[model samples]
Target: MRAVTWALALWLALLGGAAHGAGRGSAAEAQAMVGKAVLYLQQHGRQKALEEFNRPQGQFRDRDLYLAVFDLQGNGLAHLNPRLVGKATGDIRDADGKAIFQAQRALALEKGRGWVDYKWPNPQSGKVEQKSTWLEKSGDLIIMCGIYQ
Candidate 1:
């Protein structure tokens, strides 16, 4: 009985550790994906990176997370959403009337890399929710990937 109880306790502890690790996994993966996209832009150049980013089934896209590249002036250069590509987003705002694109551009230009939060419609839920984007500047453009909160 004692041995059995000890075994059960060990198993539960291992299971708990695994569950905690899984939650951290997704956040780390999102950051890794963004970092890889930045590297791709540096090595392959913007034109090639944009081509890849715009591809429907390209590596820059994965599940609910994908890369969106914009010029410093808020013009959408490459986006996962087909409608947003090639759009002039200088005055684009979030659901709450926050100028999200401008804020993103400012963060990228000032800090060169950081996270910006705003309200957006989640593609998975189709409902507006708090979302955050990790932003980094690559030469004349800003590279970003967002996660819905």
Candidate 2:
């Protein structure tokens, strides 16, 4: 009886962990996050918006999905990673050597909003994976959010 109970408990724990890990955000959710961030920027202003976006624990962050913002000059204005906040991310490339930030900049400047796909390390999964980022131009900044595919 003790052995059976222990096995059932372990099974339940494993099942719960799997269910918790399955809640990745969708593409639509990523797009919606971008829009919501834009609205927050408009209402609360840039400084506040950046603070919220850069915060690791906030409404803008969900599972592996979070907001990333860059200045017109390609400097990281807001990101969950503190090290990336003030650095130039435009020169960063993907696993395939694709210019990630340059493509994002071009799309935002030319079309004012669009999707850019690249291979990046998913923070939650700790693996390099395909991702689609939806971005928009908001004043002097470009707001973005992405989903792992």
What are the clash counts of all predictions, listed in order?
Answer: 0, 0
Each candidate's lDDT (Cα)?
0.74, 0.82
Model 1 CA deviation exceeding 4 Å by range: 1-25
Worst 10 residues of 1 by lDDT: 17-26
lDDT of 1 by residue, 22-136 (tens): 3222333456677998898889988898999889889877667788889988889888778888899889889889999888888887899877777888676678976667778
The alpha-carbon deviation from the true structure for residue 60 of candidate 2, after best TM-score superposition, in angstroms, is 0.1
**Per-residue CA lDDT of candidate 2, range 19-65, in tens?**
22456766666778999999999999988989899887889998888
Worst 10 residues of 2 by lDDT: 1-10
| Displacement of the residue 88 alpha carbon in candidate 2, Å | 1.3
